[model samples]
Target: MNPLLCGLAANPALPPELVDRLLTLALEEARADPASQFADDLLHGLADRADLRHDQILELAAHSDTMARYLAYGGTLDAADVDPGSMPNAAVALLDERRGNLAWARFLATHPDPQIRWKLASCPGLPQDAVDLLAADPDEEVVKELALWTDSPVTARLALHPDPEVRIAAAANPSTPLEAVIVLAADPELTLKWTLSERTDLPQALYARLAADPHAGVRATYASNPGIGQELIRVLAADPELQVRRAVAKHPRIPLDLLAELVVGDRAGWNLLPRIAAATPAELKEPAGSRHAAVRMLVAQRRDLPPHLREALAVDPDASVVRAVAPHPGLSEELLRAMVARHGVQVLAAVAANPDASGPLLEYLTQHRPGVRRVLKEVAEHPHATGPALLACLADRTSRPLAAAHPALPPEAITELLADEDHQVAEAAAGNPSLPRAVMLELMP
Candidate 1:
């Protein structure tokens, strides 16, 4: 009988003679017929035994390592009829490559071999019952892997784990149940709260509570929050670590009223601002031109910067501050123009959309071509320019009605805008200032 014909033979099951045929096919395949060694014939012969008793299947498993290995390698275990006798050992191999059935996997999920259990935890159809059973596995490696796999909804169940490492492991899962993680954040164990607070989406309320946690590490997370609550911030400010203190100093949300206090020291613990020649409001108006670029850069980003602060930045030693002021909403046209003239196109592009920008700024955009309708709107908003000048820009075919229904545009400015040919521009104008009287007459047609 052709060996290839063995699969469709009268006795399809692993009839004893079929093994001898498969072995012969393997030899024929070895000489250079790579296709003959294919496990299909062997797998078919093994799988054909639908009536094999569970013990008989396991007995077959013990008798021939070659057959067991073939079944494990091919991932075609149906012929085994029942879980193989060496299921745990077979599982260790298939689970590694992600190629086994749920029954094969669950058999060794609690197997004495840590390697076997770890691999099973990662199996795609790992049963929840298996997960629940292994939750108490002594190996931290096993516990940690399970934690990563257990979706957050189920992570809460593991929180009661007596091991702090396990609880913290559960906390590290991005999907850890919010309630469970939140409760863990207040856990008396310093490690638990400290670990939980590092998660960015943890509720602000929970973070604030951790800000004053007895453990310094727990408080570190709050220190890093640029937008920490003012009350929580006060607690972090008192933290002993200089690094934590620096984080507080750099936080964008700290009120200018408090920024004054950070003026004293540098990252090196020495007065670093002397180089920049600027200081927080308490020590000085702004950083000196030759001062630390970081301090000045930080000042440039400060939303609290007032007119005086901007003026101070106008001649800032580093072009960064002046560049920052070029786009600053708070700066006057006079100040913005000075910065743009000093720094050129890049800074000009940043605030090109400010409605308060001047005609000169609009004029600059024309020179640069980098200025789109976005820049024109800034010119329209500049306090010095007449409404007519801004209205003419609405005539821009490039980008019509830069700021539609913008509250800052005057009623007359809005009225004339209605005649704009561009539909979007005309719509913006029609919706503006109760519609232009001129438009009302024109639309009558």
Candidate 2:
């Protein structure tokens, strides 16, 4: 057998007729010279393939070689006469296929190795006796694995198990009995409520109970459930806990009025505007001009604001609103220049990072704000940054790392940065992707 034939046999693009010819030649060569390593290698390569025809696999299984039979079986024992002991791989393969006689399942269920028994426990549709044996296995993990199976006949028993982890897995299984759902719903374990709240199939009584669960985590989790009706949303929206209200505000079905109401009076709290799906311009106009800077900050974060609104928010008296609107794509060139002039250091970095900021605006920042290292760093990293601005950033130590990663950096500059004392600078230069092929070759170990 040609040693090169081993690789040719495994090529997926090889025609079926050629593959068959190669297999026949390998078999003939193997039988003629049993100790030929090249023959054995070809046979092993053919036998290990998943795409082989059923007839080809059977041919390999009938051969005298043991590993060839193991690979041909491909983790399935559909063959009528498999001697597992003679083919050691069959022992693990049997459970992977989940196909075997009741006797085999019984034997594996009681195997001394907990890992073996654990694997058997997760197999779907196991015989009742085997399931019973695994349910009583000494290893908690084996029992937990059994609990995770939705079709497990012993779900009711596993749900009431002493260990909370086992019960949690059982509760997560959708096939768990309704009676078990009631028990786990009221289970003192706080974590169980958190898990049960995410389940949409639970009875309404359980949903109601979870909505008002004493623990804020449970209420918050329940509030986020999509199946919860508008009434529950209303209930959670009024809950004393801020986190629960926040979760309710995020529901896609939440009433626009309710979402608009939640956005108010949260001065230092979360920005609910972006997360609220139904927040329209009409709904937000009032909050956009509210006395509270926090509410205005949320409005500024919205990307849908009209040009006038974006311009108004860009120059908001509050620094928070200015910061939020600086990166917004809607701001005009004149507005961007005005923002940079009005709020020099405060908004410079944010303006530099804006994707919509023009190349000339970036150059202006590079020329006028040369002393602001953070602004220079943001400009160096900005995709819209001009070539001259990038070169200027390359000269500044603070901006050099980001400048090295910029595609506009000259090849000579990138190559020199590769050997800089700072490894970060060298790494950034190497990752530029457009580095000359010669430079990349030098980087190879």
lDDT against the true structure, per candidate, is 0.55, 0.73
Each model's total of backbone clashes? 16, 0
**Top TM-score prediction, candidate number:** 2
TM per candidate comes to: 0.36, 0.58
Q: Which segments of model 2 are wrong by more than 4 Å?
A: 1-164, 173-180, 187-191, 200-208, 211-275, 280-282, 289-291, 305-317, 367-374, 391-399, 443-445
lDDT of 1 at 345: 58
Worst 10 residues of 1 by lDDT: 1-10
lDDT of 2 by residue, 265-361 (tens): 7644454443432566677677678787776777787766777778889889877678788888967788888887877877887788778888899
lDDT of 1 by residue, 1-445 (tens): 2322332221223234443444345344434553553434533454445444454445445534455555555554443333434556555455544565555555576677797677666554466777765676778788777776665345787776777777888887766777877777668783655565446677667777667667665566567564467776766776787666666655546654454455434533223222123345643443433255545655665445566765677656567556555555666777666666666655665556445666555656545545445455555455544444455455555435554444345676655555545555555554443443444333321
Model 1 has a clash total of: 16
Indicate the residue-level lDDT of 222 in model 1. 61
- List the RMSD of every prediction in angstroms: 23.2, 11.8
Give the TM-score comparing model 2 with the true structure, all chains together. 0.58
